[model samples]
Target: MSPSAIPPDDILLQVTPALPLPEVWDAIVRPEQLTRWLAPRVRLELREGGPFELFWDPEDPSQNSTQGCTLLRFRDQDEIAFTWKGPPAFDALMNRGTRLTEVQIRVAPCPEGIDVTLEH
Candidate 1:
């Protein structure tokens, strides 16, 4: 079956961090900084219209993190939704498409810290 056969759903990941909302956002979402903890390297054009790219391994930037890895949406110091593409078997079972089927991340403070949640 092709990835287009599956239905699309909004993936949400939330986590609570000790730091403030803006601080947490800077630490986790900022492209260059995110690599230190999250991925190896992230090039994010944070805007309503921008390209978001993440390279899991500095050695190889062409391959997606998995299969459907892409950035869908991002809210400053609040939320980030991205396509999760990895593990062929798992990707077929969960993520199989030009678009991402799963998002792995943290959400902090509806108004203010970090609330982290993962959705697929």
Candidate 2:
């Protein structure tokens, strides 16, 4: 389905990090950096429309990780938008079908450091 077709009940998360924009960008895009905090394992291609997968519990045989996610858009250190499909329970809660939800991360320079906004 087209990205615009995603439902309206999206989850949003934001934070301000005491770091520069470039650093914040790396923490979001780089697989090595992302696994440190985001997920247990992240496989991503840093390009528009690239495929990505994040495994939160790789060792758990019964858990369904965030599979078939895709990178919808990427703009240097400014913004990154992707698709996210959580486990079955999440799908039930969100009343989602086969279509995946959208997650967007925006980075901007601030007086103190950098402001990061995550919309899912």
Which structure among the candidates has the greatest lDDT? 2
Cα lDDT, all candidates: 0.59, 0.80
TM-score winner: 2
Q: Each candidate's TM vs. the true structure?
A: 0.62, 0.84
Over 8-106, each residue of candidate 1 has an lDDT whose tens digit, in order, gives 644333456667667766876787678778777676776533555666765755444542255677766556766556545466565446555546455
lDDT of candidate 1 at residue 113, scale 0 to 100: 46
Off by over 4 Å in 1: 1-14, 62-69, 87-90, 104-106, 110-113
Off by over 4 Å in 2: 1-8, 60-62
Clashes of 2: 0
| Deviation of model 1 at 44, angstroms | 1.1
TM-score of model number 2 = 0.84
